[model samples]
Target: MSASTEQPEHLRRSLSNRHLQLIALGGAIGTGLFMGSGKTISLAGPSILLVYLIIGVMLFFVMRAMGELLLSNLQYKSFIDFSTDLLGPWAGFFCGWTYWFCWIVTAIAEVIAIAAYVQFWLPHLAPWIPALLCVLLLLSLNLATVKMFGELEFWFALIKIVAIVALVVVGFALVAWGFHSPAGNKATLANLWNDGGLFPHGLSGFFAGFQIAVFAFVGIELVGTTAAETADPRRNLPKAINSIPVRIIIFYVLALAAIMAVTPWRLVEADKSPFVELFVLAGVPAAASLINFVVLTSATSSANSGMFSTSRMLYGLADEDHAPKPFARLSKAAVPSLGLLFSCFCLLLGAALIYLVPNLLTAFTLVTTLSAVLFMFVWSLILCAYMAYRRKRPQQHADSTYKMPGGVFMCWVCLAFFAFVLVLLCLQADTRAALLASPVWFVLLGIGYALKSRRAGKPDQAGS
Candidate 1:
């Protein structure tokens, strides 16, 4: 590689506290909460609230560990950087590539989702058009500058925040007024337990809820990735991470509680959005259209996040010689242009697949399931890295102002929780297939790592 190609330009620190906070907020709230929560409700009943609370609490620890590690060393770009330093190069290779692939798969799914959501309005339009256009739009915004990507996500996240807040507020009002639905069921807090109690589906149903609910929290660690571009992460990152619990209570718990209070758990359609269902029950004008637009932007926001994260992950990998050097090269805007384009190109192929595949929804389910499984792996690695940091850098942990609560003990707890979720995946045929198919990715990574290591050795041999 030439010196010019190895220019030391790095990710800019343009994202302010608001961007970090919203990005963190956006990561916490995913499309699954919008489109997939009904299935969770049907599977777990009112116990679904408990399921989300557990996941949120567990993931908050994961984020805290991640935040502490990142702040411990400002030179670290992401968790991948810390993982590589604390664990080994192999850890970095596997975590980096797997994370990159995870987002690629997620971005593709989001693209497909965007197309399907568009079809709700433009029934006659081809699915690929909107999917392709969505990718192009995100690519353009991300390529412009880091702040532009931040701004795009800021508004995208704002829309979701507004929509969710509206749902909760309206839902509470209906319950207060003792509003009755068209089905003659009164909207009240009793709806949460009136049917068959919170665990109406039993422990098995509660366990089943973990399978889908885990996916809702897939992007929760995304704030860690933005550490490089975030301005004053020391002050801002903690603020974002510490507020996670409150956000979860408001966004997931309160919002879902409101939904059930208005509609009842048994009444939520497993295949449809409870958010839209709640609005329809509330007699909102054009509720379907309104919720449809919110979900569309939600999907878009998720894809935008995937694009930004993947490029940065690739850039980080390239900086460590885990990927091609060109990926590390930045545009005039300090954006990882090549990696962004590469990820978008993969997304475009997903658009093409949407045109070709007859059963894209089924395929999408498998893809998302696989993504959820892999994300757990990444989260596990974060905890593992945290444990390693605790053992290897006790001084840093001791001196740090923002040490992870529960410390290494929480790491074990979080890891065990992920393992439990993985076991639950086996109970369902779809998730079981995804769980079983996950090894193929690792097998491929092992082979790639060995080859890269051997090739690295050859140059050293010649020089000696």
Candidate 2:
């Protein structure tokens, strides 16, 4: 197939249903769940499970709305395009740019996480070395071919799945068989509620957990981004998206329940990962090393997905004339070569920053909070796009096959929810510092957009 002059048809629908399913799973399950779950449990106690379920449901509906919009127009390759066409040029511009920023910030976090994970085995190595090497590896894989990216993600996701399944299985055996710990104590489900009674921290704790639990579901909407590249999107998209609820329940809720069952929630250390703790409690000496490797793969998978989605978003923007024409260029293998390289270059900044500031915890916290804040911006834009679709395209709404369940009402609700989360960020001192730092990022993007608009002799065509 020849590439289109206006909008390059570079992405081949080569991804199978299995690939789409696993991609969605990989996007949903990230290093956040592996490492951050301990903090969430500390905040909400056992009630964090409810927080995960709630955020998952809200995001599921959000994804459904996104899916309906994408399927309504086969030409829509990414949410940015749909937002631009349905909402306006400004919505598309803001959504596309913000989403790109989201991934870039997320990539930084993933790289930092990879360095931290590597420190488990190589404590003396400089963090920047692994961080730099990881960026190069993912960059090479992503620049190869879309199919290569899919295959790479498939295997990376498979590792995460197998690791989680193993943890859950071992946890169950320890709980059921009454396996004694090194301390001569038998494991049981009573650990979940015995110490603090599930919500020991009370309603405030449960509410506080929502602030972080929502972060775990940050990239779940990535399934829609793969629509243009998946073979038979109509069949595979729904199959991948429809299974989101189940995945949320099993991976987030059940996985947490299993961990809490085997080990008391209070005993779960905030500094250590729950997955690592599970193996240790189950009397596995190598559990820490094993879980560390799994988390490293998880971080790589996240960074890989971030690179893929960001490049496609840039490609879509270029097609709409919102980005430079060069970004629309494609290699023989149908990969957005320029966009991929651009994103990879942006990732290298993470390595440089790590070199300048060797404090891993400070770097990790800054990148992670920035990523979460930017993701919230992206989610809010999606809700805004849905609201715009309702206002401007009532006919499309009437003719649509699959519609967002609550229409404009729920759009407002979700937007409100997003705003609340932002406020919570301000309430927390560490997150507040990150949010304060975020404006500098927006300023840089705005300056670039302005310069590009002037060069093109257009009135900021980004969102129009």
Candidate 3:
């Protein structure tokens, strides 16, 4: 490798407290809450709220472990950085690329979602056109500078935050004033239980909620990616992580609970956004038009986030020479231009798939499962890294100010919980297929590592 290519490219620390806070907010409130909540409510009734709480709690501990690991070593670019340091090179190789692949699948699905949402306003616009345009816009913003990414996310997250808060407040006011859903069902807190009760779907439905609710929490660990670009990682990172439980309660649980209360779970259309329906029930004029715009921005925000995170993951991989060196190149603006374009290229491939696939819906069923399974690989690695850190660096753990609670015990708990979620996923045939397909990723990565190791060793033999 040439010295120029070997030069360390530092990611600019342009993101401030507000940017970190909002990006953290954006990560937690995916379109799932705004949109997928309808399906969740339909399947599990009101128990979906508990489903969110359970997934959120397990993930919070994961974040805590991640926080402690990142803070313990300022040299760590992201959690995967520490994974390599604590575990081994192969662990880093597997985790880093797996994370990159995870986001690629996520970004592709979200861009397709953008196209779907665009149809609401432009009934004739092709899905690929909007998908392509959205990816390009995010690419340009990210290419400008890291702060541009931060500012865009700040506004995106603000929209979601304001929308959810409005839903909760208006929901309470309606309950107090006794407004009825358009269906003539009285809008009261009793709506949560008046129909068939919280567990109306039975134990089966309650567990079923986990299938989709887990997807809702997909990017919650996004704060970990911002570690390198954050202005104050030690302070900002801990603040962002410590607040996950609160965000889950407010942005997810309260938001869903309010939606179900305004319109009973039975009334929520299984395929439609309960958010738009909530306002329509309140007799808010143009409710569909208004919420459609919000959901549009919601999908755009998520796709934008996936773009930013994937580029960084590739940059980290390239820095380690596990990926092609071009990905490590930073433009004059200090952004990973090559990595951004490459990720965008993969997204374009997804666009092409959307254009050519006979049934886009069937394609996404496989994509979503692959996404969930790959993310589990990355998260489980983080827990394993934490266990390694605890055992190897007890002094560091003892001296750290932002220590993970419950010590190493929580690590096992989280791992067990993740395994259980995988079991739940396997029970469903569609997700089960993805679960099986996921091992192919590790198999491929292991093969690459073996080849790379052989090549690296040959150079030493030549030198001797």
Compute each candidate's TM-score over C-alphas.
Answer: 0.96, 0.92, 0.95
Off by over 4 Å in 1: 1-8, 458-464
| TM-score of decoy 2 | 0.92
- The whole-model C-alpha lDDT of candidate 3 against the native structure comes to 0.86
7-88: candidate 2 lDDT, tens digit per residue: 3456788789989999999988978899999999888988998899888888887887887788778888988888888776
Worst 10 residues of 1 by lDDT: 1-10
- Which residue pairs does candidate 3 place in steric collision? none
Judge candidate 1 against the unseen true structure and give its global Cα lDDT, from 0 to 1.
Answer: 0.91
RMSD of each: 3.0, 3.1, 3.3
Cα TM-score of candidate 3 = 0.95
Candidate order by decreasing lDDT: 1, 3, 2
Q: Of the candidates shown, which would achieve the greatest lDDT relative to the real structure? A: 1
Pairing residues by index, what is the TM-score of model 1? 0.96
Better of 1 and 3 by lDDT: 1
Cα error, residue 197 of model 2, in Å, equals: 2.2
